[model samples]
Target: MKVNKDLTATASANLILDELYTNTGSSSFNLEHDFFYGGAELEIWTMANQAGILLTEDTDYTLSDIDDTLTNQASRNVYKAVTIDNVTYQSDDIYFSYQACADFVDADDRYMVTREDGQYWDLNSSGGFDLVVSDDITFKDQYLASAIPLSESGTTGLEGF
Candidate 1:
């Protein structure tokens, strides 16, 4: 899929997820229980405008008398910024951030069950499982705004100045 990298970070993530589901039988796949446990990682990357360029093709043309054709098409060099996000990560921060969950109808004490040797066990059993829960999720209506400006240069081309 072709996309303008600088503006489609979130869209890229969604596309990755969609592709996974599609390839693995979308109708039978469960995102949380299947894909997450199946070891799927989401990663994102951002780059400055200096790293790329955008080319704009000109539409203006002149008529040629000899061949009876249009000629002298105009075009402009437009700098482009690219941002890439994928399932594979290039940084450590994104590599370690992941979460998984499961659903059980039993009581909290018996949420998790396991078997060891010849013994059946529950999470709350002696030396069974250690559960930790946190409620530190932050929700924001809008993102923090910055005053960065887009500028073009003769040597380095377009960038945030």
Candidate 2:
């Protein structure tokens, strides 16, 4: 299955999840497809962007749900400003580079569980990856909205997607 990263992160993530579920018989764990694409991936993008890190196609990082992790060892530059719960924390404080931090946030399994209404948190404290909340689920909504114009009424009109 091919996925376009340019599309909102959730759609892209769903494509990945679909491919994985088809090939590996994996379950989405009650999380929406948008959780991976928009929530996890976008968190990486936002954190990287906030650190003044530009994710170039080759120089940046890539996300994989097969093993479920985000990695960018290209430059290994550490970040200093990372805000969590409105409190800023430094990557140096945790001795993790910005990319590593993003990877941890995106890939860690504990963060995937539903904690409350619209909230998912890290239940593991072993690695100290810091607590993060999932955000930006609109990508899936936008994809669904985009489908309205193409849907025919009966046959699955999810052709171009």
- All candidates' lDDT scores? 0.21, 0.26
lDDT of 1 at 115: 28
Q: Residue pairs in steric clash, candidate 2?
A: 9-37, 10-37, 10-38
Instruction: State TM-scores per candidate.
Output: 0.15, 0.18
The per-candidate count of clashes, in order, stands at: 4, 3
Q: How would you encode candidate 1's per-residue C-alpha lDDT over 51-129 as one tens digit per residue?
A: 2221111211111111111111111111111112222222212111112122111223231322223232222212222
Per-residue lDDT tens digits for candidate 2, residues 56-129, read 32222223332222213212222212222211221212111111123222432333434336554432223331
Candidate 1 scores a C-alpha RMSD against the true structure in Å of 26.3
Report the Cα lDDT for residue 113, model 2.
Answer: 35
The stretch of ten residues in a row with the least summed lDDT in candidate 2 is: 17-26
Root-mean-square deviation of every model: 26.3, 17.7
In model 2, the Cα lDDT at residue 127 comes to 35
Clashing pairs in 1: 53-80, 54-78, 54-79, 54-80
Which candidate number has the best lDDT? Answer: 2
Candidate 1 weakest lDDT stretch, 10 residues: 61-70
